[model samples]
Target: MRQTFHTSGPVLMGDQTNSQEFHLSLEQITQAPADCTLRYLDFHGTQAKLGVEYSGTAPFTRDGIKLSPAPEQAAPLQASWCVTLLSPSASLAQLQQLMRFFDGQQWTLVAADTLAQRPECTVIRFQIEGDLNFDRARLSCLRVADQLGADLVIQAAATQRVPALAGFDMDSTLIDAEVIDELAKITGIGDQVTAITQATMAGDMDFCESFKRRMALLKGFSEKRLAEIAQELPLKEGAYELLTALRALGCKTALLSGGFTYFAEFLRRERLPLDFTYANELKFAEGALTGEVVEPIIDGDRKRKLLTEIAEKLNISLERVVAMGDGANDIPMLNLGELGIAIHPKPKVRMQAPQAINLFGLDAALYLFGLNDRQIEKLG
Candidate 1:
């Protein structure tokens, strides 16, 4: 039994016992392959993916031959790409020559991404068979893939970068407690607020109208307590870095939340380039829950309205904007943008988003613009 592993990570040079480590960058000059994967690598080759044979965890085999990770008796510290020879009957010497041609400088490989795949491709697919960590192994695979003339199909991971607008969901996205629910908590009507919230987000209730209903329940929360809870909200991970990067890129940012303005403004005060923000306002009278909310609350429709309004105000196209959220409330706003990428969205939310980022941190949104690892390092 044999298996092919593709991975991408830090570069390895020479032999492990006495070798140097340096970044091995790759450049793709031609059309990519059908696909590839880094089960053991990061090179996701369209060609490889297209022809892959998965037999319920069985090793990949073609005809009667098993696809070995590496050939037996292969040289140490050597890499080879398995390309179908012009002449299937070509001698091993011809194969070696073909491999040698690609290992030369004409080809460049980075991680698992391949630069070319066709016959003009005198290039070949490279494989490095060795034991290493996932990160290390991924790098080795790409290094070998590039060295052998074939492009690594895997892409370089994104690094954080530039200023871009960030429209937030103040309630759960930016802060913890929903102001409406908290008011309910304070007024001893927590169940009422929560019930309305779930029903509204579940699409079972009309956003604005249901929101008005919740606000009516909080008609008189005190202004002092709004300040109190604002201090207690926890910012999401990498929030600062994400904001700083976006601002650096000259992004027009704002807070688009269903939560109250009370806590949203508190976040903007830390020096974020908050152009404007929108959310429902709790009608306050004294320092306690009023049991009634203000009218014309910012609901789901309001979010979509604000998205269009903001884009026009910034003198930018919706294509230049990126919105993130985890609930159904974000869908309308998301649709108005050029690329609505879901960030750790709900199952339904993820399904609707044209682009989605779930594996990396929320800041991974930076990758959508094609910034490389090195460029991202400069952002911080």
Candidate 2:
């Protein structure tokens, strides 16, 4: 049986555009039968001399005609896309289901790389080709991921270059706990401050206003207690590994947080090897908190500006930066990076950010950079 394929597109000839249609048989395009012949009229609708020559199954080319095996040619209308799926408990069944879903959409999967594999987490990167509809593709993948209890991130598969700079939010991103809420606990106003913190992170309340209100409740909180809490602050799982890998790749790292500098600096000094740390400063007098932060609060806008300034000062392009955060206030800085990642962010932040990772540890993000488990292990 002869299978026919129809392809149509606008062909530009000098200043005129004409619709050109080609009806090719499967064998002619794929196998190129020895006796096969293809003929088409000139764009001017006049009898024009043409020549065709085939040499040992090689693709045929003429002055105005080119034919090659479909497998060797990329359709002009298609684009490369990256779909990354991560889950703490992903199974082969889930991966197969996602592959089937992509097949249903007619997107050709060019490659599937399992970046990480462990009982606690699994990361898989899928490189596909299809017409670009990022929003739709994201939504579709989100739906599938949700069904599989996984997190899916989709974006154009641009040239894979290790980022030069990485910026992170402190609260709920690098660490599992919110610094402000931790302070509230020490002030004996945990419930009240926690409520405001939740609202601010969800973008329901203004960050600056909420910060002041929370600070007022912590008036006179002991600096001794703050230092103790900083020491006890739990780093998020996989954070250290992620930072170590970034350092190995020669990437400058920064903590751009709305949280206080005391804790951020502690993390930089004792915990992570951060290249820079920027956060609000807490006023202290007589070994106690004064409930007032220093001037120039590092709110959302400031976070964005700090990320930009650091990149500029370091002579790094914005395209070679990755920003990760978990709050609405982090949205600006997150969007400023080439890869704006929401690390288990608030619903509002997850919806607004370009990509999110909710299913695994901070290290799962390395897969987005196209690093496989072997590469990550070598980096460490």
Candidate 3:
């Protein structure tokens, strides 16, 4: 997966001897080198009154604004690390402990930069110079983040790139609710259908079989009711902001779902500003659901295929495609994209995907694109 580092936090160092309390201007902090892995600079007189913590090899920021070096002072690019804290209360001590654990390992952690700053979630970039065992480091990061109730994303310097196309899983990833489950509710079989959905999405049962069973329970439901559900589809937090921002960046967006085209089409035409959408078609007869999906189900494999097709059509490399999902069915496309991000995913999805977002709104994905506080603020 394409990896980018976006970080911001107070470098809380318990070691006072090496920790120098010094004041620096925003420009000075911006011009700071990326080679220092753990440097804590107290920001004085800044509007936000926030301290500057640099842990990765990228520009530092407070909130979404970058603390950059002056025009003539930009440093040469080096290794990059992106660390995102999904939990608001994750202490620097936890990170310090992680690095200390790594201290005995092969890789050496160096300087860092802040990317996006929020109270609940923060992203930081770090520079590493060593013959490191990346796989081991990744495992350690996952373990630590899980224990600390946070998320950690690591991208080697070479893999970082801005994506040209992004494919999003619709039902749970983009919208807050599952359309099928909602339809089941209307059919008075909500509990049964919801259980099947959970199992299917958790990879316990075949999605096709589970879907067929669920749809059968919804047989004879009015198409008008489906339309009503579509009208009330609640988008996940930051869905609109992320899509709009992506469109502005000339990034083509596609909604790839195993869910019905009814709601996906509604989102494209009436709500979200997506450029393309591919989903399973629901069969209807005389303005009523026939309790069947069209042939050639848009399952996980199909989702991956569609992602590749969309990337090819846009003339974008798979290395510049970002895929987001929240279910077991999304595993294929999640692995297919250059950056596979699981948003509030199931336990199975969380363990497999390289990156995940659990603590913040969907907009935080923007940080993965290397945007800073200033750029994000301007998006408003």
Candidate 4:
């Protein structure tokens, strides 16, 4: 029987001196025919075989037909995406509809693995065959999440899916409340502070300027009260679980925030296993608020730079880094990391981030890394 082999480029088969040219006719392969196995005798007198079961072009055909082993053209590099459903009642119908959309775009699913099987929250990982518009995928996931009362997280498939260093925003991300807003409430300047915060998070005002205005209002505030409030900062849902799991996996964590250093230090010391903490230091004199932060405040730009520095110190590429945040100032670092997650972020952040978790707790972030309940339990 006549057969054909589709090679990407010139390749030396077996020993260089023993290599021989054996060219065959090329046939156009449209759809993968059926379950087939290609067996051949190796130069070393051993049996070599290849299995083809998926609906993709075969690289080599035994029936004088041109075939490819991949979905389409020979791709030396392929991008993968992990689609996780974080709602117990996620609709299969919606998922299938999205899959159909993907198929229409000529994207192929190489494999589908179930990460979580809970009825309330089902997580699935799909290894795709090609590149995709990740931003659009995030939006689609958001729509599905809204429809099914679910939360969706989409991540790029990577050689190192788990980051060695994880950077998180302190307010409304690692913790359930914004420290500044809480302080404002205590000082009876809640309304004014809240307005500034909304503007700052909405990208209407520069974060540093807004911070200065807010801090100015808290002038003469007692340092002891700040410490007391810092100790009472409520942790975000799944914050402890997420950090513990990451620590168990040998990953270093950083609390990078635009919030005050006092609260960030508190979380690092008592709540989470943080290796690094960077935030605005509240300048205090005579045990009272000085109404000014230390020079060169940690703003959005600083946050981005810190992530890069942390990656360099750990000798990891930017792609091996994960950053999470929930405000306008967080856009920089979020975009800098390989996996930038906006957790319950503002409207602008929601639209810009490539991955986000809206419905579930901070623990849902674990699903983006393809971790299921069983795996997480083992870590604990």
Which is the leading candidate under TM-score? 3
Q: Is candidate 1 or candidate 4 better by lDDT?
A: 4
Give Cα distance to truth, residue 126, candidate 3, Å: 2.0
The 0-to-1 C-alpha lDDT of every candidate, in the order given, reads 0.48, 0.72, 0.69, 0.68
Query: What order do you get sorting by TM-score, best first?
Result: 3, 2, 4, 1
TM-score of 3: 0.79
Q: What is the lDDT of residue 202 in candidate 2?
A: 96
- What residue runs in model 1 are displaced by over 4 Å at the alpha carbon? 1-164, 271-273, 287-295
As a whole number from 0 to 100, the lDDT of residue 147 in candidate 2 is 86
lDDT of 4 by residue, 79-130 (tens): 4665555555433243445456457656665544455544345555555665
Residue 316, model 1: Cα distance from true site in angstroms: 0.6
Off by over 4 Å in 3: 1-77, 130-135
Better of 2 and 3 by TM-score: 3
Off by over 4 Å in 4: 1-79
lDDT of 3 by residue, 299-362 (tens): 8989999999988877888888889999999999988867888888998887788777766667
Alpha carbon deviation, residue 57, candidate 3 (Å)? 31
Models 1 onward score TM values of: 0.57, 0.77, 0.79, 0.76
Evaluate residue 268 in candidate 3 and report its C-alpha lDDT on the 0 to 100 scale.
Answer: 96
Worst 10 residues of 3 by lDDT: 68-77
